[model samples]
Target: MLDRSRTREGHSPAEALRDTVEFARRAEALGYHRFWVSEHHGVPGVAGSAPTVLAAAVAAATSRIRVGTGGVMLPNHRPLVVAEQFGVLESLFPGRIDMGLGRSVGFTGPVRRALGHDKDDADRFEGQLAELLGYFTGANEVPGLPAEGLRVPAFVLATGAGAGIAARHGLPLVIGAVRGEEPMLRAVRDYRAEFRPSPLAAEPYVVVSLSVAVAATAEEAWRLLVPEAWAMAHSRTRGVFPPLRPAAEVLALPMTARERSLFEQSLRGHLFGTPAEIAESLDALVARTGADEVLVTTSTHDRAALLDSYRLLADAAGGR
Candidate 1:
């Protein structure tokens, strides 16, 4: 997990990075197995803009936790660059690195352009994923290969149509369970049925990334997440990026009925409540999808609160 959301007291990016390092150290101390940072372009609230760079920082700070993206949107950059970056990370961290790649742009049009990518870039993601794998396996023969013959574990992040690709590639698959249990279960079943063993993976592996925020009380967790709900609602109507505001402040703003619906739906896959409540939800999620692991993504403004949430979750989940 990554400490992602912006601080209301105006913390600098350097401060945020240091806080993230400390957060990773705490999570490692608590016995979490892996720490994954997300890549989001042009999002004001999320400071994990470059997951690879952040992964390096976290890796350098913590000695044991496996660190990687959860994930890096493959269509946004060249696959070779990604291969080289992860190669270097693998060199530095050895067996404690994992790469999770996704096909979505994770942003809107203007921001995508600023990142040197266009809408149609997603169409080439499958081919690029293959090329990236080849680079890691030292099978790709492109000019000026960086750290050839170095293999790093890689996984694919899939939602709808991309599940088949994960099966075909035989890479560990992570499904976004935002829709519901039915879709996620079906997708997992399909992936397992179609899986072919690869050198990196002897059997099918599934990780479901779900939204969760745990606190001492359900209402407190819900109240803290209202700002996230509001930001998601604003994004559906106004586009990808939105400024952060206090939950109370966001709730006071006028919104249409449809916008309200979108807000609720945006939080559908999330488990927001006390530790016991979140644990029950997570247990159901794991039982339903049969996921090997669950990657949690929390949306909160306060860093300490975010760390506390994970601490509760770790205790509830019976540790690593």
Candidate 2:
């Protein structure tokens, strides 16, 4: 998981970049497979505005673990530029770069405008994704296109019809499973059914990213998750970015019983508990989804607590 909160809380962008590099290095040392950084614009609680830049830093800082965007919102940028960025990253990192592209703008109108994108941008995301893959695969070299000879391992971040596009292109698919399992399972099925062999990936590969907070006790973990839960609740109701508040403050805020129940249910699929318990839960989740990989996103205000959560998760995954 990426440390979005570090950049959100008084740390400069440079500091957040350096911290991410160090974090990736530590994750590699601890035997984690890949370190993914998310993309969020105009959100004070998330500093990963430029995922590719941070990905390059993490790639340079670590020798083993793969580094990439948990996703880059494809509609916001030119596909060729995206291709070149990942191409350059691949050139630098060789075998350890992943390009996960998402269709969502990840923001509302104002932030999207600030990012130089409009609402119609999302409509073109599918076509742009196709163009991106074409560029990477040397298919867009008819007359005057920037991408003639470039190819990298690309995965699409699918929440809906994007899954079908991933299948058509034969790209690996990563589903954001924060909402529920049904959408994810359907996407997985669609991706697998429509998958066609490609140079980058011949078989279907599915990865799921979800909220996770593990502690010595379930109660402690639940407490740590209050910030995230509250964030979700606020996002659902208010539709704005709120500063990361204390968990006590979160709990103290007025909440209907139904709202509280929704938050609890939202937290259910997450891997939380002691090492052994997490491992068992993780194994079951993987089994249920047949996912090749799982990305854990922990919502914590304390950096130490966040690191400890990842360490415990790594241990649960049978890593030292």
Candidate 3:
């Protein structure tokens, strides 16, 4: 489960964060293997700004569930700093920490400038990743705190050109299952074919991520996606990403042709429906891509319903 700790229309950022911790507990009890939080900066709809800090909170709050970032953007910070943070986390949490890293800097120009990185900084992700791994393996001369001999499982998020990078580093690849299946499948195929064994991993591994909402009926599940879809459309068109609103409220608002088009576009490529429907979809997805794991990232305005969706999904997937 990769939660962004989205703030709803009526909730405060603090409340949203607390909700994430509580949700983590629910997810653990429901048999989830890991609970991951995401990183987002200067986004009105998201409250998960500092992923490592939030991860510490989650780790301290839960005992059995694995905790980590869905990821921390490497281009935005020095690799040594990230290595130190994760080292501390691993020291405290031991085996339950994961280091999911990404190359994204910021969404807009101002945000990028604020982060002290330009767009091209993302091009250095491969080097940054290598350096981060070097710190863990003691390949670097700099003697450090716990960063030098700690092994926190690291996974590379497949953002542009990321599939190749993961393969070259012999790390686990985390790719989205959306934006159509053909391209995603091709990337995974290429990753496996081009993979090189390293100290981190001996074989290619893929974790496919996508938003999923399971309900008693198809319509109910579909409605659960409306909040996120609307928010995405508004962000793309207006440049202002607001909090999630109720589906009924969003449905009643009038949208321009472009907004309507973007709204529908955002709603595509998701897994939603009853348990039987989702079970079939999961089986086909695994058979098609041979994904090692499915990382579910679903968001909605209805908190109780959101929890229900995961519960149903756990029952449907049966600990997979």
Candidate 4:
């Protein structure tokens, strides 16, 4: 599960962070394999701006579930600093740390300036990623540093040129359920075909990430997606990305034609339905995409229902 630690209406950012730690505990109990937090800067809706720090909190909260970023934007920081941070995390947590990474710079111009990076910085992701990974193998000038020789596993979040980069590096690729399945499928096939064996992985590995909601009825499941759908629409229509609102409140909102269009479009890639329905759909999706793992990133105003959805999904998958 990849949680942004989304702050909902009438909720504090501190509460959102605490909720994420609590969610990790619940996910551990429910037998989920991995629990990942996300990174977002200057977004009023998201509280997980510092993924490594939040990852530490989540890691300390859960004993078994693998904790990591879903991921850290490589463009925003130097590779050495990131390696040092993850090195500290791996040193503390040992085998349970993952280093999921992305190449996004920032959300807007102000954010980019604040982070001391521009969009062009994202183009250097491949080199930065290599340098970051090299530290674990004592590739730096000074050997046996904090990050050197630590075996923290890394996964790449497939953004612009991420598929090809992951292929060359032989790291696990984490991709979204794209607008059309064909484009995503082609990328996966290309990644597998071009895969180069390395210490990280011998064969191509793909993790498909998406929003999933399970409930007794399809309408309820769809309703659980409303908050995020509305946030999507709002972000596109307005420059600001606000916190999540209740499903009922969002449903009653007055939206323009464009807002409605984007809202519906954002809802296309998500999977929400009854347990049996979701199970069959997910199975078919995995078969189609050849996914080694499925990472659910569902968020909703109702925490109880969100957990229930995960519980039903686990039961449907026959639990751990």
Top TM-score hit = 3
Between the candidate structures 1 and 4, which one is better when assessed by TM-score? 4
Count of clashing pairs, candidate 4: 0
Off by over 4 Å in 4: none
Top-lDDT candidate index:
3
| C-alpha RMSD between model 1 and the true structure | 2.1
Count clashing residue pairs per candidate.
0, 0, 0, 0
| Candidate 1, 1-320: lDDT as tens digits | 64563434355656666777788898899888888888877776567788899999999999999988888899988888998898889888888998988888757677887888777788788899888888866777773155467767888888776788889888899887657777878898999999988877889999888778889998878766776777778877887546456767777778799898987776565688998888788888788778899887776666667788888989888842
What are the models' TM-scores? Answer: 0.92, 0.89, 0.98, 0.98
TM-score, cand. 1: 0.92
Candidate 1 wrongly placed segments (more than 4 Å): 2-9, 12-14, 143-146
lDDT of 4: 0.90
Segments of candidate 3 deviating more than 4 angstroms:
none
Tens-digit per-residue lDDT, 1-320, candidate 4: 88999999999999999999999999999888999998999999999999999999999988989999999999898888999999999999999999999999789999999999899999999999999998899887754358898898899999657999999999999998564777788889999999998898989999998889999999999999999989988999898888999999988988899998988987888899999999898889888988999999888999899989988988877642
Q: How would you encode candidate 3's per-residue C-alpha lDDT over 1-320 as one tens digit per residue?
A: 99999999989999999999999999999999999999999999999999999999999999999999999999999888999999999999999999999999898899999988899999999999998898898887775458788878999999669999999999999999555788899999999999999877899999999999999999999999999999999999889889999999999989999999999999999999999999999999899999999999999999999999999999999955
Q: How accurate is candidate 1 locally (lDDT)?
A: 0.79
Candidate 2 error regions (>4 Å): 2-17, 142-150, 254-266
The TM-score that candidate 2 achieves is 0.89
